[model samples]
Target chain A: MDPVTLLTIVVLAVFVGFEVVSKVTSTLHTPLMSGANAIHGIILIGAIIVAGQASDVWILAVALLAVVLATANLVGGFVVTDRMLHMFRARKPPADTNTDAGTGTGTGTGTKGGAQ
Target chain B: MSLLPAEWTALLYLAVAVCFILALKGLSSPKTARRGNLVGSAGALVAVITVFLSVKLDNIPAILIAIIVGAGIAAPIARRVQMTQMPQLVALFNGVGGGAAALVAVLELGHTDDPWVRVAVVFTMLVGAVSFSGSAVTVAKLQELITTRPLLFPGMRWVMSATLVAAIVACGFIVATGSAGWAIALLVLGLAAGLLLVLPVGGADVPIVISLLNAFTGLAVAASGIVLGNVLLVVAGTLVGASGTILTRAMASAMGRGVSGILFGAFRGGSTAGSTTQSDRPVRSTGPEDVAVLLGYAQRVVIVPGYGLAVAQGQHTVAELATALEERGIQVDFAIHPVAGRMPGHMNVLLAEANVPYESLKEMAEVNPEFKNTDVALVVGANDVVNPAAKTSPGSPIYGMPILEVGDAGQVVFLKRSMRPGFAGIENELLFDPKTTLLFGDAKDSLTKVLGAVKAL
Candidate 1:
């Protein structure tokens, strides 16, 4: 394919992706972005391959730049994701018992004939 | 050499853009985000297929292998993560996208020896490195692997400012001499600065910080795309960058925080300390059976759930109790405060997931008046929101925040673990109310006992 056509198609695809992303509210933002990020990683790999085979110095330069940026994104994303998972794993503090009722204190209200 | 008509190509791009718009629209509601994602993905797939068809591939297997491997790892991780952790997961993923864009920029520059390309490579490298490092710090903070407290050092601000200055000088040096070493050093400085910049931010400001980083990533990616002349990259990056910035601003405002306050960790005041004064008044206590007796015969019972419900996984049990109450021919309703949990609409989602009937749930405005007529108002694992402090104390951190007027009910039964303060670290004044009876235990355990008592009645 001609460079112009390739560029055109790529641009269109990205626009579509953006339109989809823009529609997502807070509820869907995270998941949609996550899915898109994976796609970006795919793009990164492509850029890397393209860099490896480039006959022109400019192409090689661009490819290397893409690879660096993409790698950072991939690694950083995983780190943050792993960190968030920790929030769910916190050990709930044991229940404080000093405030427990039904003890000898008559201040405690009870149903008639309620056991201590 | 053109393979496709320009008009058709433009049309296809327009279609892709429409998909993005639709996907975003659908994403506004949780119920539709999944479908929105599918539609957005389909657009991406179309783009990928177009690219595949346009390019002459000598080795298609390599592309297939990469896709399979990447999807295999990501799909499982995505499936395993719970909804609560979704934000952190998003932060991680967004960081990766930023990093990827930076890498792409670097590769694009490496392919060219042109001075302009060299300059673009430097910019992309610095931005990408910083974005990656900043995102990592954010993730660490969110995960609690790193301290949520401000990791501030004396003169930390000056040190960061100096590093940023040095980076700028290094960028100039790289541009002047076209030296790759200088560029690399500049990137390193930016990365270090990114980490330092984010590390000092407290946990309270993390959501904003994450969003800001997301915006930065988007901008960096867009810059890289512009440098490489990838229209797709530019368009996608711009959209992300713009949207992320808007979101960051909105989130900051929603939390009543400013960007500066979030950035410098500057505004830690009375709010952080929580409510002022420990109430000296003693709390009224109640037995499970007595509470159950009151509940069993109550003409109307209102169950108000808070963060405690999420911590104890008590939604299912709460649902069961509601069912039991309804079985006894009592009017039961679950009153949900908008900001009842850590996030908005948190209580609603938890209850919905537990299969509680939507008809039983009532918003604060809808049910606040009902408390007057309610025979028993059962507050489950809730504190600050239902606290009388919001009403009585002008000095309280939660003073101005709107709360459920559970105290107004004829009889208030609070199912709490203890008299301990909430996340804001404030003692709930509602505890001291003569009308309020404390049911101290695990909310689930307390509710179960109450249920038992009710059944026994």
Candidate 2:
């Protein structure tokens, strides 16, 4: 974990991030933003590590709270992004007539995978 | 119980990082976007499992319960939130991620004696706190828990400046002395700065602020990676931070707003004068039957929809109206201003929700010129987007943003609740144009009536 190594990784990651999303259509902006938001939920790893290693009760309590927050951010971020994309994928000879209610109640990332 | 050695855990984390890159790439196009999301989710699943297997430590039961509690809170809400409220939900999710990152950094504070690591810790805590607070304010604004208008107070600029200066000073003290007290002070100041940063930004500009804060959270997460010596943390965080920054810029330009103008506009007060005052200027008033006659005769029509359409739950009726018009062999198209509905592309989601076909919902640039050839521009619950003042008035808040030129159409029909202004709080000059006719009512009722009238014709 040299500072120089971290700096190199940050710079390269920045380029990749900018290059990946450089040409998205406006229709995908909200979904894309939500997806990117979800990806950072990987900070859950850092949270897990911190929570698992704490020796003090106060530190453990704070770290465990971080875990809960991170878990929610990660899970919720993916589910909502998935739900939004399900609607965006509607471009055919119409799918379900009640796709709105279907997705509204069934709101599933799994809905996309299993239904298809 | 460690399944993977340190190097193997590192390698798996690296693979997970590449999945994120692919996820963002997949989202760039409509066809691959959902699949891209699935891939990213799979990566997340794998990462979580790997962490459980590769790290052995205390409080395992507590950790599981915490995770379950978190998911229980988030999943139902994300699943159930209406598409119109998508931007705020994203803001809310982004805020929790930032708050979590700040907490992680806080616990790492005294463990690091290295000044550079301490610097990263300070950076993470401050940025994370600011992003968390700023996003909360944006959510409240969008949810209308608070007034949507810019809440400016006396000496607000000075308070913000002083807080920022104090935070910077606290960060330096934490770096020099490695003191927990200075770190806590920096965190509090960061929260204040975030609140101050977003509070003055008026409603029309909250989406951009959310994007900016999303980027802030990403950077904070990246710095937390530095604090913990985790390469995956560094890469994933920087990716979100950098991409979110660029995306914010693109959205601002699409909105015809400079980033600086959005962030600091309240300090330069005169630029944000929005009037809630009703204009009594006479506009031609008509009923659903006359509108049907106008639509009943038109060969070509363009529909301009705004946030009000979503507010009135009129998407289904509006789509029905479009379908009804198309049945008569009229050329009908929906001209979506880029920032239409609240966020960019937001109208597309709403229209898609109502089963409006994708091919007919046209972007502003693609549909602007077509308005000239249009026989009618049926504006439904939309005001400022079609307002000619964007092009004509240099002094207006939304002045330079490109607008759908519905004014070029032969006849304009407005379905509105009242003669009130739009979200930007500016009066629409186009409403008073002689070619325009106002049908006053709730958008759903109005569209339903208009739909029936068009059917009978």
- Sort candidate 1 into its docking category: incorrect
Which lDDT tens digits does candidate 2 get at residues B1-457? 6467998899899889988888899887666787789999999988988888788778888888889999999999999998889889989999999999999998998788898898899899999999999999999999999988888899999999899999999999999998888888988999999999999998989988988888999999999999988888899999999989998999898878899999898788887887879988889999999999999889998999888999998887787788789899998899998788888778888887776766788988899878889999989878778877788898888888778898899999999999889888899988888999999999999988888899999
lDDT (Cα, 0-100) at B165 in candidate 1: 91
Per-candidate interface DockQ score: 0.12, 0.50
Lowest-sum lDDT 10-residue window in model 1 chain B: B266-275
TM-score of 1: 0.71
State the TM-score for model 2.
0.95
**Candidate RMSDs in order:** 10.7, 3.8
lDDT of each: 0.62, 0.87
